[model samples]
Target: MKRSDLSHTIRETLKRLPPPYDSHYGVVPPAPPEEGVSVAGAAKALDAAQAAFGKVDAIAAQMKDPYIVSRVLTRREAVSSSSIEGTQSTLDELLSVEETGDDGARDVSGKLRPSGGVVPWHQRIDFAARPTVGDTLKS
Candidate 1:
């Protein structure tokens, strides 16, 4: 906005700045309306959210086998962390690996494929890690 408009706004807000920038100012956003949302609608949404949370809590609390939970969490962590580290695999692919004991398979092109059937995102080859000529040679 124009400096003059900013100065006028600042004066209306009773705020002051130092030096030549005394005329410069930032606009303060107006507070939200107290009655913006209907109370009944908000209450219904909250109830639904609470019900979903309670269901999850109940399932977690009722875990009959600790090993099952541990195994699930471990696989989740592995898949998630490996994706972050670029040695990526999906949870389903990881589970498939555990079941089949296969590290990798070749696609029709004979190139290394991430997983079978549809191409999962994480399984796509990361070509950026490939070493350039400079990487292979001395200075």
Candidate 2:
């Protein structure tokens, strides 16, 4: 069967099936019907379902036409040199990484060692107190 037909069948089957059930404190509650199952609800459900089904149908229809599919899938030549650059800039902003200058750049040494350089005595003591995995060798 066609993919769209199969999808519609599956959707219909899901609609006919009983809703899920829930349990609380040894009590089981009957499953609520799928959203918009009533006449009023069905209208809303039908609209949404039709919209989604329409999209799938359109895609399936396109797939049946090899020329249309080829046109849809064919890579087009770059329209503008800055298209990729613009896309990257938008991505950088979305990622919260500053794309301007070296503002966000990090220095490895600064990360490994902080300013004023000396390790605190308490930290050193803690390090000495830590038992290395190799300490089991002695046991």
lDDT of each: 0.59, 0.39
Please write out the lDDT profile of model 1 over residues 7-80, one tens digit for every residue.
55465664456778898564565667987855898899999999987886677678874335445555666667
Query: Candidate 2's C-alpha lDDT?
Result: 0.39
Write down the worst ten-residue block by lDDT for model 2.
72-81
Error of 2 at 16 (Å): 32
Model 1 TM-score on a 0 to 1 scale:
0.33
CA lDDT of 104 in candidate 2? 36
Q: Which pairs of residues clash in candidate 2, taking residues 3 or more apart in a chain or in different chains?
A: none
Model 2 residue 65 lDDT score: 47
Highest lDDT: give the candidate number: 1
TM-score per candidate, chains pooled? 0.33, 0.20
TM-score, structure 2 vs. true: 0.20
